[model samples]
Target: MVTKWVLLPVPAQDADSIELDIAERQRKRGEPTSPSAGELSDDELASEMLRRTTFGAFIPWPESALERLAAATTETTRRWSIVMTLCAESPGTLFSTTDISERTELTIGEWRTACRHITPHLRKHYKDAPLWGPGLYEGSTEWPLVTMSGRQLKLRHELHVGITEEQAKRWRAVLNRTTQNVA
Candidate 1:
């Protein structure tokens, strides 16, 4: 007998809650709120929101490689849903080439090349902010772990809610399979 293993990356923290909040807001308000506000004009607000939401956490990657991999891999509906939810919730928290290589058991070089392939698409679609200059974010240059205000918190909450629902679905499926085997 052979055992097959499937490796799925765990959803980031608060993914479900954030998704729920976003969905609810869209339903009730009919307008998505900006992720953050920091005393700026309209243009500045747009730029800042784009920067904060789009690519704050994740490392940049190339486009072609990502496309090939996304095409080749057979992602389940659940996985795709999770990915979409993640992108909506926090587009900035992307995996770097190195991070992807390490997590997915791919070679660093391969991951880097793939990242290069996908990056252009990400840039074009996501419109991430420019890289932070030296001495930003409490003088450490790292992405801030905490959201800046209540609005950001609400968005994050919705993302987590969506993640939770997905997790519950997965867990229930596992339980059902186990029970069927036992019977």
Candidate 2:
């Protein structure tokens, strides 16, 4: 009979130090995260105004937005994720429900249902929401952002390079006024 074993080199750190390092890493992982903006409710908006106001513009929302979109569970938010995906491709660009459906692989009806759900949370510069009339395509979604004119779609805090500073300022004023009216 014979027995054999192989030995592998280990770091020289003491057991106590290794244990302390593991505990520190675990504790760091349990640290709390700030509340998500999605947690806010329309009713709680007034009470949470200060917190909400601090929520700055996320135009061209970071790549993390795609992660959020892919993880969306609800119908409305799922649609928002889709629309935002297209818009992100060309910030301040125009797109329709067809574009959205084609891009996201969702049915037109389903896309519309999702679009209706997000209409309220979006900006309404004209008489209606940024989207909802003579969209990029007929009978499709309209611009889903703060807009000053037909082709000037206002992203969170970004404007197309062609737009002048004066126009951007005016758009800001218009958006501010519209936002105030809603509040």
Best candidate per lDDT, number? 2
**Please, what is the whole-model Cα lDDT of each candidate in the order they appear?**
0.36, 0.41
Q: Identify the runs in model 1 with alpha carbons over 4 angstroms from their true place.
A: 1-70, 73-92, 117-183
| RMSD for each of the candidates | 18.2, 20.9
Task: Find the 10 residues in a row with the least total lDDT in model 2.
Answer: 53-62
Mind giving the per-residue lDDT tens digits that candidate 2 earns over 97-132? 555566777777886676556544333212332223
Q: Clashing pairs in model 2? A: none
Error of 2 at 119 (Å): 4.2
Worst 10 residues of 1 by lDDT: 156-165
Candidate 1 TM-score to native: 0.22
Q: Indicate the residue-level lDDT of 52 in model 1.
A: 51
Per-residue lDDT of 122 in model 1: 34
TM-score for each predicted model, relative to the true structure: 0.22, 0.30
